[model samples]
Target: MSTTGLYQDQHLEINLPQAMVSVDEQRLILTRKEFELLAMLSANEGEILPRNVLLDRIWGYSEEIRTRTLDVHIRRLRKKLGLYGDSYIQTIFGVGYRFQRFREPRALISYQSPLFAATA
Candidate 1:
């Protein structure tokens, strides 16, 4: 089994000590908040972390505090990671987000963006 980041079978790797993340062996640059966010999600792979929990953990803010920072961070992270498939983080809609797990190494086809529908 290939253990890259927080979980096995994942192509991405997060070196917390180095504060770095690599996708498909390519290094990625992220802001401080972005790195923290990725680390949290990677640490809790397969588990859905609520927006409130994420904010509290990463930003050290109470759940009652209102902010769209998490959303912005997530968007930026996704863009940097070039993530688009089920193997990456997933939105739970009105709830939270989950870092999905990979069962095996995937091919380019698996990275197909959901933004583009399959043309029959």
Candidate 2:
């Protein structure tokens, strides 16, 4: 049996057995909910986790129920994480949230339609 469930990426590390999180080698003191929330998001990585799904998973809330609990927690988490949280955890407007390793630099890439491909 493995007591340690490690979730890590380029900048973050989560140790489930110890309920510990470290970002860029700095440890963060987090509440139980905050830790859980971060763990969930980190586990999913780049995937967009729906609000309903997060509520259900973290708080056992039904999809029919409406609340701002998730938002509040996210805000706190972002504050605690500082610039890292702001850059990683993203709001999908009316949809939900996602945790990405780093902000994508899509603006640097120019888009070319198929019709213009031959000319360029």
* Top candidate when judged by TM-score against the true structure: 2
Q: Against the true structure, whose lDDT is highest?
A: 2
Model 1 lDDT tens row, 1-120:
124444434567778767777888888889999888878887887789999999998999997899988998988888887854345778999988888765565565666787797988
Candidate 2 regions exceeding 4 Å error are: 1-4, 103-120
**Candidate lDDT (C-alpha), each:** 0.78, 0.84
Q: List the residue pairs that clash in candidate 1.
A: none
Per-residue C-alpha lDDT of model 2 across residues 1-120, encoded as one tens digit per residue: 123567666667778778888887899899999988988887787889999999999999999999999999999998887767887789999889998776444677677788768863
Clashing pairs in model 2, backbone N/Cα/C closer than 3 A? none
Q: What is the lDDT of candidate 2?
A: 0.84
